[model samples]
Target: MSATRDLHDLGQSLWLDNITRDMLGDGTLAAHISDRDVTGLTSNPTIFEHAVAAGDAYDGSIRASVEAGKDGEGAFFDLALEDITRAADLFRPIHDKTDGVDGFVSLEVSPQLVRDTAATLAQAKELHARGDRPNLFIKIPGTPEGLPAIEEAIFAGIPVNVTLLFDAKQYLAAADAYLRGIERRVEAGLNPQVASVASIFISRWDVAVKDSAPEGYKNRLGIAVVQQAYVAYLELVASARVQRLLNEGARPQRALWASTGTKDPEASDTLYIEAFASPLTVNTMPEKTLIAFADHGKVGEPLARDGGDSEQVLAAFEAAGIGVDALAERLQQEGADAFQKSWDSLLEQIATKSQALTA
Candidate 1:
């Protein structure tokens, strides 16, 4: 059996972290689903920026949107929706078979609106409606400003993939937002089965501390942090609070490992994927990482529910002067900034491509 299948059979979903029109046109996305066990996908500003800028694959669509008098975010979403909804259809079978537990494709809300709760909600609802696919998740950042929007979006029956979470605390905050949304639904006599995932970013921890960390700690911090979060995830899923919701027909918001692509080239390409392997969670891999893992990814023993040595490992980093809690905030902020930058770039790319396609 393929190691990718092994990972999936072990109960962790393998989701592709990249999407482009070419991937769809070339049948690569569908092939990834069938051959690599990539049951889901997640896209971001960076991914779209790269996709639109890299080639003429999107040029025809850009021309159509431009001709329709769409520009900037409107044109961009038109392009994004076409790609995502098609990808969503590809996964719909799995989505139906699993009863909404898997087979999701995510599109992030405008990063520029992350801090504006009202704007974020408006854009989120708009984009979700635009996609119009039951398996499509409108991604919202897990920033403080994003929390209320996350809750409101879920309460409105929009599935969310909460992005940019850096630590267990951030993950829990996103979960709370999801819980509140479900709770409100139950009280209002709505279905409480809105699906969601709290995407905790890995690898960024190590990237952030790479220069400061001792050699012995070089690539270990990210795994340790995610391990700690996994412990919290176990507790959260088993908590009576969530159980009460389950009784009300709510599905527990799952934990997802983002940024699983290794930044440090010297480290094993599959470092995060192999280490963060735990049942009932997800690991969204970049195409490179997914290909690498499929080639030789070993399913190591799954992460211990108690987070074996996670606290101790984190303590060692603390002793080394890494203030994790503070760093988590910084990383989250940095992530939002980075997404905004990517969003700006995506708009510019779309504008450039539109002009070129029209001219």
Candidate 2:
């Protein structure tokens, strides 16, 4: 069996962190679902930006949106919605069979609204409703300002994939927001069964510390960070608060490892995927990584719930003068800014493409 199937059997979800109109039209995405055990997918401004800018696949749709009096962000969403909803439909069976535990496709709000609590909430609701798919998750950044929006969005009955989290603390904060939303729902006599996932980016930590670390520490920080986060996740789900919520029919916001593609040439292509394998978590990987993993990946024993050796590994980094707490905050901010830059470029691309297709 393919290693992808092994990971699936191990109960770690493998979601493709990519989407494109061409992939959908060409049966590639469907094949990944059927053949590679990819139960879900995720999209960001960067992914959509690349999709729209890459080929003539989107040209006809861009022209139609332009002719229909849409441009810029509006045109982009119209295009994105079409692709996401279609992907959502393709995964609907897994979604139904798993009873909402898997088979989700995430669509993020404009990164420009990351700091705007009210606007973020509004757009999240709008996008969730617009998509009208049960398995769709409207992604909101896990920034401070975004926490309230996340709470509000979840309370309002929208499933959220909280993004931009860099470490365990950030993941906890996102979890708090999700739980608060569920608690509020229970208080208001509403269904507290809203599904959510807190996405903790994995590879970026290694990238951030690669230059300053010793040879022994290279490409290890990210896995250690995720291991630590997994400990926290295990604790959170086992806590009385979360257990109570679970009894009340609320779902736990699962830990999701994102940014999992190896950025280092010397590293194993499946570096993050192999080390971060644990049940009850999601690993959303790039297309290259997914294909690489299926081709030659190996799954080891699952991560230790107690975070074996993670503290010791992190202590080595700390001894090397890496302040992990501060670094997490910086990475989160940098991630948001990078997404915002991509969002801006995406809008510009839509506008430019709209004109080109129309002219």
Candidate 3:
């Protein structure tokens, strides 16, 4: 059996972290789904920008949208909705078969609106309606401003993929917002089966401290952070609070490992993949990383529910003068800034493409 299948059988959902029109048009995406056990995928403005800028694959659609008098976000979302809805259809079977536990496609909201709670929620609802796919998750950042939006989105029965969380506290805050939404639904006599996932970024932590950490602890911080969050995840899923929601027909929001590709060349190619093998969660891999893991990856024991040695590992970092809580906040802000930059660039690219294609 393929290692991807092995990982799937290990009870973790393996999701593709990239998407493009070319992949959808060709058999590449279909192949990944069939042969690589990729039940889901994710996309963002940056990925879309890369796909559009890489070639003329989207020229025809871009021209059509441009000619139709659509511009900027509307035009861009038109293209994104087309691509993502098609991808979502391909996974619809897996989604239904799993009873909605797997086979999800994520499309991120405008990173430019990260600090605007009302706008974020509005756009999230708009995108969710535009996609019109049950398994299509509208990704909202798990920032302070986004927490309220996350809750409101959930209460509205919109599935969310809470993105850019860096630590257990952030994850739990997002989780609480999700819980509040579901609890509100139950109280309002609505279906409480809203699906969601809190995506925690890994590998970036190690990169953040690569130059400052001890040689022996070169690639351990990221995994330690994930371990710490996983402990909280296990606790949340087992808590009486979540149990009460389950009784109300609500699905527990899953914890997803994002930014998992190894940044350190000296680290194992499958470093994050191997360390993050846990059931009831997800690991969204970049295209190459997914292929690499399928080629020669091994799935051993899963992550510790109690977060074995995480406290000790984090203590070591603390002693080294690395304040993890502060670092997590800084990393999250940095990540948001990076995504915003990408969003700005992508909008410019879209406008340029629109003009060029139509002209």
Candidate 4:
């Protein structure tokens, strides 16, 4: 069996961290679902930016939308929604079979709204309503401003993928937002099982600390962070508060591992994927990483629930003058900014392409 199948059998979801019109039209996404056990997908402005910039696949659609007077971000979302909606339909079956636990496709709100809680929440509602797919998740950052937006979005019954979280604290914040939203739903006498995932980016941590850390600690921070977050995740699920919510018809918000692709050339290609395997969690991998794992990846023992040695390793970093708490905040902020840049570039790309196609 392929290692992708192995990971699936081990109960960790394998979601492609990408989507494109070509993948949708060429049946590549469907094949991944049918043959490789890929059950879900995630997209961001960067992914869509690359997709729209790289091909003629979007030319006709761009022309049509441009002819209809849609331009800039407006034109971009229309094109993106078309692709995401189609991808959502392709995954709809697994969504139905899994009762909405699997087969989710995520669409991020404009990264430009990352700092405005009200606008973020408003856009999330609009996008969720526009997508109109049961398995769709609105992607929001776990920034301070985004926390309230996440809570509001979830309370409004929108499934959210909380992005750009870098540590246990960020994950907890996102989880708390999810719980608050669900609790509000319970209070309002609505069903509280609105789905959500807190996406903790993995490899970026290692990349951030690579030059600062000792040789032994190289490429290890991301896995240790994941282990620590998993411990928190287990505690959350078993907590009285969450258990009560679960009894009230709510589901525990899942912890997702993002940025799982290896960033260092010297590192094992499957380092993040092999290290972060756990049931009920997700590892959203890039297409290259996904194909590599399916081709030659090995499934290792699952992560220790108690976060074995994570504290000790983190202590070493602390002793070495690495302040993880401060770093997490910085990383999350930088991530949000990076996405904003990508989103702006994406809009520009769409504008350029649409105009050229029309011409």
TM-score of each: 0.98, 0.99, 0.98, 0.98
Cα TM-score of candidate 2? 0.99
Could you tell me the lDDT of residue 211 within candidate 4?
91
> Clash pairs of candidate 1?
none
Q: For model 2, state the Cα shift of residue 322 in Å.
A: 1.5
Worst 10 residues of 4 by lDDT: 350-359
Q: Candidate 3: which pairs clash?
A: none
RMSD of each: 0.9, 0.9, 0.9, 1.0
lDDT of each: 0.93, 0.93, 0.92, 0.91
For 70-140, candidate 4 gives per-residue lDDT tens digits of: 89878888888999999999999999999989989999999988889999999999999999999999999
Error of 4 at 208 (Å): 1.0
On the 0 to 100 scale, the lDDT of residue 12 in model 4 is 89
Q: Give the candidate order by descending lDDT.
A: 2, 1, 3, 4
Give the range where candidate 1 is weakest over 10 consecutive residues by summed lDDT. Answer: 350-359
Evaluated at residue 346, the lDDT of candidate 3 is 78
lDDT of 2 by residue, 1-359 (tens): 88999999999999999999989989999999999999999999999888877978887778888889988888889989999999999999999999999999999999989889999999999999999999999999999999999999999999999999988899999999999999999999999999999999988898998799865889888888998899999999999999999999988899999999999999999999999889999999999999999999999889888888889889998998899999999999999989989989988988888877777
Q: Model 2 scores what on Cα lDDT? A: 0.93
Error of 3 at 106 (Å): 0.9
